[model samples]
Target: MDLDAFVSAHYGEWEHLRALSSRRTLSGAGADELLDLYQRAATHLSLLRSAAPDPAVLQYLSTVLAKARTASLRRRTLSWSRVADFVVRDLPAVLYRTRWWWIGTALVNVVVAVLLGTWVARNPSVQTSFISPAAAQQLVNHDFSNYYSQYGGADFATHVWTNNVWVAALCIAFGVLGFPIAYVLWNNVVNVGVQGGIMVAYGHGSEFFGLILPHGILELTAVFVAAGSGLRLFWSWVEPGARTRADAMAHEGRSMVVVVLGLIGVLLVSGAIEAFVTPSGLPTFARVGIGVLAELAFLAYVFVLGRRAVREGFTGDVVAEDRSATRPTAA
Candidate 1:
């Protein structure tokens, strides 16, 4: 079809043009072809805009421009480095912006941990009491001390990393269900509480800290982030602000997708540490130091670095200043 006829036919179908442009194949030849077509369309649009062509022709030109813009964006997005940059830059911003949810989840975890600690501190026997007698006997008979000694080996590292990744992904995925967040929190609380009770019962509270705290700070923080994302999803359904529930959920899901992916990175790093480093029978003070440092780094990232990056995103440049200026003032 001739350019004028093509424009006339497609002028109002900007969305269709955009979809077609974004489907350009990912290859050197494909990219070159798409870029060439985009440039041609853009040039045509500029000429049409200047000429003040008929409304239909102008509409068609607008579709061409829209398609070109879409193609350009798709090309940029498909770059490996662009993917990495998005992960590093935008992911943190998403987490930072929704940090109140993260904080609430973290506080919930801390309360659970503290309550377990208190319970153990009160009833020393409950730790052993809560577990099955057979389990307690098996644990007492097994050389758990030696098992702990070998905990940070390669196999353990692989297992921890895999398990943590699975858990993190599940937490995010299950957020689609309204009750999954609650289920995750309940399970985590029980596991942590039971573990704490076990440590105190076995007179291994201090030893447990040395084993867990180094990586627990990062590991648990990752869980909290996941929980926060899930909570945000739940809140969208229950308390949509100025939007239909479906619309709010969709919007929140877009934001949480990035946050959930970022939390996966955190889980991977934390899992590696938990598997290979934390179980090395390190000194309590050293473990605590590492934990504290990790906590500080997370706080700085979420509250400072991440927030600053988001603020920098707003450049105060008016994208449609002419259109705004020409529009009539509202009554």
Candidate 2:
């Protein structure tokens, strides 16, 4: 290969590519042109490396390729509008669609906790079996309340956020298996029941309810949402309805991802409450009122925004172009 001749032939194209990459905005046609030009320059680089091996030319070509790569990535990166659409439409739609699953899970958890808590509180033997009477008194008198205020507000909020997020994530991640969701919820039920039972047994039931309700309302709701998402994913494969099993599972799985993102925000609010509001010197009514308001805000956001999105033919899955292709075997 004549290195000089080859350079002369592609030099104009290289300059054009550089110009395109430097542009402030790229239209579809310009983007297409830039991509084609980039590919051609890459080929030219390969030829030069193999035949001529000119270091200056290779270095120049490498710079152009890097710039082009950056430009391509810049074009594909998420814009504010895309983010707005996701927040306004995608998150809520999926949450709305999955509402029944989480709501049902929440109800069952609550019923179990209430019944078991009642049993534990009423029975002296059960309370003693769970914890020494002295320990139970300590928890009732100090430990339970102290747990919320042990750290500064910001540190406690972060700790609570990370822990709750992990629990919610596990519920979604293990949703397909089905059994883990049961285990997590059951574990949660037992903990709440035992704690409540012990507190009541020690004549401090009011304190337990007062401390928990502020954060627990939203915190447990988020957990239920996660558990529900997992159950929905499990059922997608089990029944699959009119869709093929793979297609159903894929569709529901994408929807579950939306729930995960939305729940992160939900848990953060709850964590904030648990850290600052629940433990703060505010009156009990004021603290619980803040929690109730937070819970209502989340419910309204999901039902209003999510329901509207669902009504507009958005099922909380990725847009049509982004979805995996269904096989001909799909029912």
Candidate 3:
């Protein structure tokens, strides 16, 4: 086979296929021409491989065939169906899957915060280290409570949402490294502890709980979820069990996308509560009740809807067709 002669004979059809594949829209006639070109290109590919076997020509023709095949096949488009499936299955399943990571994180951190708050309250030296006596008094007396209502509800909500989401985003983004997430958690709970301790020491414990619980319950829970998801990402590569480290990292990383998106919604709700309910004239019980309900609703979403999705073999991962190829397992 004369390679140059064969290429001269069939290059037009391959080029034509390439052109058609690159097109965004095609007419009926153009579509028919594309299919014809696709078939001819496939044949040309086979002939070149068997006879001429020129690497460059064979490679070009192979690429044309692949593009033509893909262009002719049905392309998946976004629709309500896909969005619904993602919300109902993908997001919740991911939340459910990483529940323990964040829950345990929350538990340990909360205990740490409580213990630290107690220590701070008892030790005048520790309290002064955080702030001078005058500043501490100011924070407990007026600054702490006034912070909630200073801005209008809408503005405050947006600010709080943006800030909380930023924190959550950092936790999710740095999940692989591990220690950065611990530092973020440390900064977060320490702030909570310092303020709570100051409020308690100043004889405003009830006021502290009243102002904080309304949004803190859900807001802090969302933060915990983000941190937990990050910790799990770290653990995925560390203790991949049967899977290789890269495979585990890839699988968990994809699922973290769902968790990241879901946390945005969670944080939004908590922000709203912080801005409106926390500062409203509503009774403390009513405000805190709302927060509790929101928290419970989220828990039910994970344990109920999330569990159902899991039972159906959902792993918070994209569909098998969409994700990377799974490694073959040995018996």
Candidate 4:
């Protein structure tokens, strides 16, 4: 392995790789040539490392190869156009298809929350158990309402978004394990119900609704969606139907990822309402109305756009091209 001779023979190939990598644009032929040159250069580098290696020569080849790899990956990266396509076509379709899973979760949670709140409000003992009489009175009198206005609007919005997103993410991440999803939903529902009961018991029921509903409706819906998606993922493995267990889980996992990303955006809207609108000087009707409108808009997106997408044969799964090839096996 004569290092000088080796460099002399492969230097041109390395230079070609470097030139192509440095180019701002490449034609089809030029791109093919660049790839070919890159492969050859990589081989040369490997040979240099394994055979008679010179520090300077090896350094040069390595640098050129690195640049070529970067350029190749940049060309393959997703463009803004692909992002738009996913948002318009893929995301809503999956949400629509999985609506049943999360919708039921939402209804059950709502019922439990209302019942718990009523029970707690009607029982002084339960209310006292949740919080001291003094603290409960304080929350009912001031703290509950004060929370909305304590921070600046923008800061509050960011804090609320982050916290809600964390909860939503936990629901999805733990939903697969079955019990965790139930636990998370139970904790959230009880917390809401308990707070409502405390407020109502103290004679600020209107204030509680006014403060909570503006953000709670959408925020809780997002959490329920995550929980539902998680439960569906668990079911995919439990009752895999005709597909292999692995295949069913893979499909549901990918679709749930889409739901998680979409919920980030949804939680952002709810956070903004909680921070800015809920605490604003608007009347209770108008504030609650805005929240209702936002909730309805999300439902429309899931049902209208999602249903249409499903009817067009979208299942919220990745395109066949992107999924693993199915291997043939003995029946």
lDDT of 1 by residue, 1-331 (tens): 2656756654544444455576755577666766766666666667666665667767756766676676666534358875755655677677777789888888978998779766864674775567765675455445334554455466776777677767776777777785777787788877777766666566667766666787888888888887787777788889876666776676667666677567767776776676656755667787678777877887887777677767877111122331123322233
TM-score of each: 0.67, 0.88, 0.80, 0.82
Q: Give the per-residue lDDT digits (tens) of candidate 3, residues 1-331.
A: 9888888887777787888988978999999999988887787788888888888887788788888888898466689999898889988899888888999999999999999999988888899999999999899889999999999999999999999999999998889899999899999889999998988988998899999999999999999999999999999998987887888899999999989888899999999999999999999899889999999999999999999999888888878888787686553
Worst 10 residues of 2 by lDDT: 322-331
Pairs with backbone N, CA or C atoms under 3 Å apart (clashes), candidate 2: 92-306
TM-score for candidate 1, please give it: 0.67
Which rank order by TM-score, best down to worst? 2, 4, 3, 1
Per-residue CA lDDT of model 2 for 160-252, tens digit only, reads: 999999999999999888888999999999999999988887788888888999999999999999999999999999998888989999999
- lDDT values, one for every candidate: 0.68, 0.91, 0.90, 0.88
lDDT by residue (tens digit), candidate 4, 110-164: 9999999999999999988889999997888889999999999999999999999
Ranking by lDDT: 2, 3, 4, 1
Lowest lDDT block of 10, candidate 1: 314-323
- Model 4 pairs whose backbones collide: none
TM-score, predicted candidate 3 vs. hidden true structure: 0.80
Relative to the unseen true structure, what is the C-alpha lDDT of residue 89 in candidate 1, on a scale of 0 to 100? 62
How many Å off is the CA of 102 in candidate 4?
0.8
What are the C-alpha RMSDs, in order, of all predicted structures?
11.3, 3.2, 8.3, 4.2
Model 4, which residues run further than 4 Å from truth? Answer: 1-35, 40-75, 327-331
